[model samples]
Target: MPFSVYALGLAVFAQGTSEFMLSGLLSGIAADLHVSVPAAALLTSAFAVGMVIGAPLMALLGRNWPRRRALLFFLCVFAAVHVVGALTSSYGVLLVTRVVGALANAGFWAVALVTAVALAGPEARARATSVVVGGVTVACVAGVPAGAWLGGQWGWRAAFWAVALVSLPAIAVIAATIPAGRSGAALPSARAELRTLAGPRLLLTLLTSALVQGATFCAFSYFEPIARHITGLGSAWVPALLALFGTGSFIGVTVCGRIIDRRPVAVTAAGLVALTAGWVLFASAAGSAVAVVALVLVQGMLAFGTGTALISHVFRLADGAPTLAGSFATAAFNVGGALGPWLGGLAIGAGSGFRSPLWVSAALMVVALGTAGAAWTRRSAPALRSDVHAYEQGSSDG
Candidate 1:
């Protein structure tokens, strides 16, 4: 892979850390901001809402700009927002910052994925994506835990400052490395992009992405509370547990990358099954520290492993409009991101307790499984084949 690919991954690491750091910071933010934990958790949902709108909208806005320029613009916005977030004392201001930061984050993700796959070419698309998405897993492993620790040691504001500082270097690296050119074929017209997005196969695949993310975040949005209240862990152990989850995600994405292109369906289905099983085990083992830790690792692996395949599948389906397709996939994941935490919050508010989210997560996975199964059955239908055929022809001509 090109160095630019790794640069993009670094950029993703910076953005993803900011996006997920809120999970670990929820407790601290709630305490400092004088709000309930569930209320603080709404920050995650707000970020997701920004992402769900930002990706596709940014894709359209940057449709004609050089990918490098677009990326730089987004990163600048991301870094600026984090600085603002760090200085904000009011909960309302912090919430607004989260949404604004996420808009920049979503734009970065949309362009970065397209750039990674373009740099790697057709055959290595999954590997390229893995290299980039690996940043998210790495953030899980290192960045998020570091942020959590920073939050615990200093304040949540300190973590935001750390993220902002880290983002500066990413901005410099991307500007220096990523060439200022269109990464792939000329983008399709807005009408063509919409038509391709409207296809049943693509739409179903996007739904699969959403369902998978929804299931993961349902429990993940409440991970700290689960660790503290249910598993009987102290605040000190939260970052460590988050790191363990990240370790599992890192390993899962690494392994999945190697095989996803060849066994997309099997890998995806197996990951979903493991995810559902993990959720069930987690719920049952909520009180057992060892069991909870083990289930967290398993769940993180299965969750991100499935993500690799789902993203690759979307790329295949959207070969005609790779960047827009990537944007759509990002939107779908955030839609789930927004819905998962919101629903989990409602359950908690209803007196269901922290463990309630795990049950909700399992149910969402079941829906994802059914959606995947339905899509798999129709993978061979003529309409799908024709789409693939047209994509192949376009690639050859380009």
Candidate 2:
């Protein structure tokens, strides 16, 4: 169980690095490809858009396959996409490759969640799930910064190459460590997963995910410029600052499982509140380097801390369709990813300083907090399919 969790986490880390690496190397990519920063930003947006479209679609396609085979297939395609991305010289070709890679990434995550939960056998589901998915947090802390540095020193293409190399090994690890089995329950039909997305509870969860994640990425997309304007940091220092924030995210991911298991609603509400405060502080105290870095660390933790909780929240809400619920949540995340930075960029274009985006982001988190509080006020939130007694009774057996 531990090995499978770690293997999936590593695969997710590699994918996460691939997704965010472009942000760190945006300037280099723009210059090398003879395009504007905004044009290069489109590449980032394209990846998110692909995930938004691919999450449910790919999940449906693999609805009947054994989870291990589904994962292997996706990782193989993911690796190939990176290889193509690294080798492509034409910006147009690279853009297509990135979109393809993002689709594979979405599929990998959707399938991996089910596989992780099944492998844990419901007893340690929360912790096992967290460990497997913590790869994204690790990427935020370590992989993204490493990719950024490699891009800065070697070239943007080199970062993609690094991701591909890591993914190859991750594929091998997952194949070796995870036993052969169909990870998700066999659906009567592919459309069955859609039921999870249609309910009020699931809808609310999706809305919260979109708003919270959108706010986060809105500010995150412009981190480098924000750091430069506020902290007077050079480009050379940006990656290190990113790494510091990532460290905080790592801590958040490690602790989130316990927090969620104890009280899902309270933890989520608290996380959003913290996220709001972090953004507000970032916008206000951004002029001071010390203050900015402090807020950056806080922002990383508060923003990312809700990730696993949110996933668990979805599963609880759907009670009937865990795999579908998980995939839908991922789709919501992609929706936020696609929209957040674009909104921030719009604000930036409107002559609002980089800090302006933080205001918009903070406001969004405030709204999310309100929604989460309302939905999760009771100890027996509707999202939780089973009560404490039921969960406890079943734990020993599972």
Candidate closest to the true structure, highest lDDT: 1
Q: List model 1 lDDT by residue over 1-398, tens digit each.
A: 88888888888898888888887699899998899999998898788789999999988888788989999999899989889888888999999988988888888888888888887887888888888889999998889878988998998999999988887777888888888877556667888888988888888888988988888888877889999999999988876777888898888888888888887777888888888888888888899999988888888888888887898888888877866877888898788877887788888999999999988998888888888888876786777789899999999999
Candidate 1 off by > 4 Å: 23-42, 88-94, 152-154, 228-236, 349-353, 383-398
Q: How many clashes show up per model? A: 0, 1
Clashes of 1: 0
Q: Which candidate should be chosen as best, given TM-score against the real structure?
A: 2
Worst 10 residues of 1 by lDDT: 179-188
CA error at residue 341 for candidate 2, angstroms? 1.4
lDDT of 1 at 267: 81
User: Which ten contiguous residues of candidate 2 have the minimum total lDDT?
Assistant: 182-191
Query: TM-score, each model?
Result: 0.87, 0.88
Assess the local accuracy of residue 244 in candidate 1 as a C-alpha lDDT between 0 and 100.
82
Candidate 2 regions exceeding 4 Å error are: 27-37, 183-188, 231-236, 377-398
lDDT (Cα, tens digit) per residue for candidate 2, span 59-170: 8778677778889999999999889888877899889988888888888888888777767766566676677667887988788878988988999989988999999888
Candidate 1: the clashing residue pairs are none
